[model samples]
Target: MEHEKRDHALLSASGANRWLACPPSAKLEEQFPDTTSDAAREGTLAHELAELKVRNYFYTTDFGKRKLNAAVKKLQKEDLWQDEMMGYTDQYLDYIRVVAMADRIQGTAEIEKRVDFGRWAPGGFGTADCLLLKGNQLHVIDFKYGKGVPVSAEENPQMMLYALGARDMYGILYHFDEFHLHIIQPRIDNVSEWTCTEEELLEFGSYVKERSALAIDGAGEFCPGESQCRFCRAKAVCRARAEENVRLAFSQDKGKLPPLISSEDAGRYLSLGEDVKKWLEDLKEWALGECLAGRPVLGWKAVEGRGSRDWIDMDAAFGKLAKSGLAEEAVLWEKKPLTLAQVEKLLGKKDFQDAVGEFVVKNPGKPALVKESDKSEAITNKVTAAEAFAEGGES
Candidate 1:
C-alpha cells in the first residue's frame, strides 16, 4: 500500500502505536519493500476472529445467557482463547460482557454511503469503519486489540474523525441526534468504553482534519517522545531515535538523573553520551563496510584496554601441589557471583587485602501470596447453596 493510504489506517489509536513501534510501513517503503512479518499477520487473524465472535453473540441467540455461552464457545473455536500469548493479554482491564448482543436500531439497518470525512492530506481522505443502529441511538464501535495504551472512545480524535466521515456518509438519508463511539478492546483482560455527544464528535473531526493537513504539509518531521517514537515508522532513519539508542548504551541506571524535568527531557539532555557512543559504533560499522569493499583502515591505531587476567601462574601452582603430593584439584580456583554494590563495598574493606576470594550469593526466594478471606465469598456461597436447596426442596 502507498504511505498515505497506510497513514489513514494508522490514524486509529492502535494503528498509530504499531506505526511508531515497529515502523513496518516505513521499512516496507524503504529496503526489502514487499516483506511482511508472520507475527503481524497472526495478529490480524486473531482480531478478525474476535470480531466475528462478538458479531455472532448479538445476531445468533435470543437469550442473553445462551448468547454469552455461544459467544464464548465461538471465541474458543476461533482459537482466540487457545493461544496463550496471542489470546490473553496482561493489560486487559476487564471482559465486561463478552459476546454482548445488542438490540438493533430502526435507522441503522440500511447501508450508508462512503463520504470524505475530511482531507487528511491534499489527496488523502479519512473514512469511517461503519455506522450501526442500536435502538434510537446511532452506535459506532471501533475495534482495538494492540498492547499500546488504549484510547478513549469519547472525545478521541480518531473516533471523531470516523464520526465526521459517518455524518458525511449518512448525509440526508438518516438523522442521528446522539453519536456513541464504543471502543472494543477484546485482547485486554478488561473491556473499556467511551461515549461522546454528536456536537463533540463534530468539533473533534474539524480539529483533527486541520491537524492532519498541517502534519502532512509541514516541514521537518514529527519529533514525538521516546514512547511515541517506539511506534514511529521512520525510527531507523529518525535522528531522535538514533540519539536515544546511543544514550541508552551509556546510561544503564535511570535513577541517577534529577526528577525536576520529565524522564523524556532527561533523556534528551543525556543525548550527548549517546552521540559519543553512537559515533564509536558508526566508526566500527564504517571500517567493516570499507574492508568488505576492499578498502581497509590501514595504520589506524587499535587501542587496547586492560582486560581480564590470564591464568599464567596456574601451572606453577599446580606443579607445587604435585610436589607436595596432594590433590591437584585442591589448588583449583573458583569464583562466585557478586552484585556491583557488594563488589564495591568489598573493595573498600581494609581486611580484604587479597584481590581474590570465593564468594557465594543466593536469593532468599519469592514471597507467598495469601490474603485473609473477606467472608464475602463464604456468605455468598452459603446464600446461593441455601437458595439451591429451596429451589430443589430436597436434601
Candidate 2:
C-alpha cells in the first residue's frame, strides 16, 4: 500500500491537548523544523501494514490480496521492520474484528478516512484510522503503535477531536446517537474505550472552538503543565515553563527565602520534582544541540565526553579466544535461557499458555509513587513494631 502524505492543521487533533491548554504553544512550535525519529518511522510502517491487512480482510479481491502481499514484502525489506510488528498488528486486527462483531447491526468500516471538524475547530481536520458505523452508533478506533506510554480514551482530547470530526462527516448519513472512542495500543496490550452521547461531544466541540480561536492567533497565556509541554517543540527554551518550575522550587514571600520548608511543603515539592527534573534535562539537551551546531552556548562547548572500544567482528574475536587455552563455553560464550516474554512470543500466546501457564508466576510489582489519577490501585505500607523500634533505637 502506498502511503499518502498528510497535511497537518495549525490546531491538529494529535496536539489538541497541548494547544487547548497553552493556546500560544501551537504557533510557537512552528518556529522549529519538524523532525521524525526512527521510532516514528517504524510506527508509520506498522500503520501502513495494519491498513493493508484491514483492506484485504474487509474488501477481499484477488488484486487487493496481491497488493497486500506486495506491500508486506516491501515492509519486510525496510530497515525498521521487525518480526514482532506482525504480531502486534495482528493483535490490533483481532480487536477491530471483535468490535465489529459486538454490534448486532451490520456495520460499514472506513480505513484511514479523512474527517473534517471545521464546524468547531477552524480548518481542523484529521484522519481516523478506522470508522465503524453500526446503525446509531459510531466507533472511532485509533491505532497507537508506540509502546512508550499507554494512552487512555477517557477524556483524551485527540480521540475526542477524532470523534467530533467523524460526527461532522457522518452525522447526516448515519444519524449517530452515541460516539464510541477506542485506543488500541497492542505493543503494551492496552485497549481502552470511552463512550459519550452526541450532546456531550458537541459540548466538548464548543470548548475546542474557543481554544482553537486563541491558538490560531497565539493569544492565550502559556500554561506549562507536564502533559501540555511534554511534546511541545519550544518546551526546551519556553520561558513560561522555566518560570513555572522556578516558582515551584522557591516559594519565597516578597523575594525573601523561608528559613525552612515545612513537612507539607516538602511533600508538595517532591510531587513537583519530576517536572523540574524534566525541564532541566530538556534545557541541557537544547544547550548541547546549540553547541553542536557551532553556536556558542555561553559557557558550554561541544566536546567528546566519553568513548568505548568494541570488537568489529565478534565471531572472529571468539574464534581467536578459543585458539588460546581458555575454554569456549566458560570464557567465550555462556548460554542463557530466553526471557519469559521472548519465549512466549516465539511459541505464540495460546500455545505458550497451554504449555506452561500453570508453571508461570507473576510477582507483584514494587510500590512506586505516582499521580492520584493513575489507574493502578494504591498499596498500603505496613510498618512493623520491630522496624519502628529499630528506627527509635531502644526507645
Candidate 3:
C-alpha cells in the first residue's frame, strides 16, 4: 500500500504553497519532511464542522432547535467535535439561524450544490464545499478557517480553480447566468462575495489545464513572494529562502550569520552558484552605501554602539543635603551613559574575559553585517550603487 501510494502522483496545493513563496522550494523536497501542526488540524476540524452545518441545512426537512441539535450530533459523529466543541456548535447554530432568518425575507436558505467540482487534476477530481441555489442563479461558497491572509474569491486562483471544476461538473445540471464565490470565515467576522463571469471561468480553466501539466512533470517550484513564504512547508530547505536571507544580509549592511544554505539551494547552487555569488557581492556593495548613509532596508539594524548607564558621584552633588541629615540613597541619581564599541564588547560575558578557555571571545567580524561609511586607503575598488544597479542591464 505504501509503495502504491508513493507511485501515485497525488498533487497537492501544499507544494504550490511553498512555490508561491520561492521558486526553488522543490530543492527542499527530500530534506524537509511535512508535518501537520495544531493550526492545520484546527482548520481541518472547522472545515468539517462547516460542511456538516451546510449539509444539514440543505438535506434536513426540519429547521429549528431540533435541526441545530442534529447538526451538532452530525459533527460529533464525524469526530470533528472535540475540545471547545460548544463554540463550533454555537457557530453552526448561528449560521443556520442567519439562513433561517434570511429565508423569511428575500435571499434566504438555498443549497445550490454540494461537493460539485468536476475535473481538477490529471484525474477527474474537484471540491465543492457547498453551493447556494437561489432564484434563477447559483452561489458557490467555500469555508476558510485558517489564520492565513484572507483570499478574495474574485481573482483568487484557488476559487477560480474550484469554479473551473464546478463548470465542468454542474453547468449541464443547472443552467446558470451568474456565479458567486462566497468566502465565509466563522472565526473572523468575514463574509466576502466575488462575482465571476463565464469568460473569466473559461480563461481560468485554460490556465489550470496548462499549470496542472507542470505539476504532472514535477515543475511546481516557481517562487511567488515573501509574504507567501510564512506558510511554506519547505521554508527551511527552499533555495529562495536562502537567497532571501542572503539578499537580506547584504541589503541590511550588518553581516548576516554565515551563509546558511538549505539543501534545495545547495542543489541549484551547484550550477548557478557563481552567478548568485556575484549578485551577492553587488547587493552587499549597494547595501554598504545605504547603511553608511543610515537608510533602513530589510529588517536589520545599524550597529548601535552599546547600551550603558552611569551613576552620579552622589557625595559631591549631595554634600549639603547629606550634611542636613539626608541619606546618601535619597540624593543618589543614576544617569544613562554614552554607548561605545568598548562598552558593547563588555556587555557579553565571554567578551568580558581575557584570552582563556571557552569563555574567551574571538573577534568574529560583527554580530550582524556592518557597512562602514568611510573606507580606509587599503579598501579600494568598492562597487558603487550606480555600478551595481547598472551591471546586469548594461549587458
Ranking by TM-score: 2, 3, 1
Model 2: per-residue Cα lDDT at residue 329: 83
Q: Output the TM-score of candidate 3.
A: 0.49
Cα RMSD, model 2: 4.3
Candidate 3 lDDT, 134-207, residue by residue in tens: 44355666666764555556566555555565555556666556667767665555556788777766766666
In model 2, residue pairs whose N, Cα or C atoms come closer than 3 Å (at least 3 residues apart or on different chains), thus clashing, are none
**Candidate with the greatest TM-score versus the true structure:** 2
Every candidate's lDDT: 0.48, 0.87, 0.52
Provide C-alpha RMSD values for all models, in order: 18.1, 4.3, 20.2
Local accuracy of candidate 1 as per-residue lDDT tens digits, 197-282: 66776666565555554443333344434445443444444555566565556555556656477867755556534345544555
Model 3: lDDT equals 0.52
